[model samples]
Target: MDEILDVVSLVLILIGALLCLTAAIGLVRFRDVPSRLHAATKPQVLGMILICLAIALSLRSWPVVAFLVPIVLIQLATAPLSAHMVGRQAYRNGTIDRASLHVDELAGSSETPPAAGG
Candidate 1:
């Protein structure tokens, strides 16, 4: 049982580390802000969750879980929100690649209405 737990823990940690590495690579390799945001947030959040799970598994203690549960919850809550804000900002700021978007809902909405006097 102990050995099994250790093996699982190791695998989880390795997978998490690999995910983090992939996120880093994606961050550097992706061209535009939206794509980069996707790369940065998605995998990184999963990676963090996996890493925290691995820590919980290794410790196998109620106290550790008490701490980790909140951490994972906070991370889950924040990552997407932060990503959305950044992506929205990028789109508004004209840093996102419009060509890459299949359908831009914000595009039409963002255009200012012509002044009545003009």
Candidate 2:
């Protein structure tokens, strides 16, 4: 049982490391903001979760799991949100190529506010 647990933990760690590496490569190779954001958030978050799981498994302690759970939850919540904000900002700034977007719902939305006393 202990040997199996160790093997599983090691495998999880290796897979997590590979996912992180892929995210890094995608960040460098992707030209567009949305694509980079996808690369930065999706796999990176999964990789972090896997790594944390591995750490908890190896440590085999309630305190470790208690610490890791919140870390995973926070990453799960924040990664996509931050990515969305960055991508939205990039689009608003006209840094992202419009042609790359298949459907831009935000296109019709106006950013400017109405005049106060008009």
Candidate 3:
């Protein structure tokens, strides 16, 4: 059982590391701001979750796991919100490529205030 737990932890840790690396590579490889933001946030969140899981499994401490739960929740809550804000800001500032977007609900929504004097 101990060996199994160790193996599981190692696997999770390795997978998390790979995800982080993939996110890093994507940040560099993706050209558009939205795409880069996707690359930066999505895998990073998953990686963090996986890493937290590995830590919980390895420590096998309920207190430590309890401490980590809120951290995981915070990451889950914030990462997407942060990515959306960044993506929206980039789109508004004309930093993102319009051609890359397939569906632009934001472009058609009243949520985006119109430009002054336009």
TM-score of each: 0.89, 0.92, 0.88
Root-mean-square deviation of Cα positions for candidate 1 versus the true structure, in angstroms: 4.4
Q: What is the C-alpha RMSD of each candidate to the true structure, in Å?
A: 4.4, 3.1, 3.1
For residues 1-118, write the lDDT of model 1, one tens digit per residue: 9899999999999999999999999999988888788898989989999999999999999999999999999988998999998887788779877887899989776654488232
TM-score of 3: 0.88
Q: Which residue runs of candidate 1 sit more than 4 Å off their true CA positions?
A: 111-118
Model 3 scores a C-alpha lDDT of 0.88
Tens digit of per-residue lDDT, candidate 2, span 1-114: 989999999999999999999999999999899889999998999999999999999989999999999999999999999998888778878998888789988898637436
What ranges in model 3 sit over 4 Å off?
108-118
Return the candidate ranking by TM-score, descending. 2, 1, 3
By TM-score, the better pick of 1 and 3 is 1
State the weakest 10-residue window (summed lDDT) of model 3: 109-118
**Stretches > 4 Å off in candidate 2:** 110-118
Worst 10 residues of 1 by lDDT: 109-118
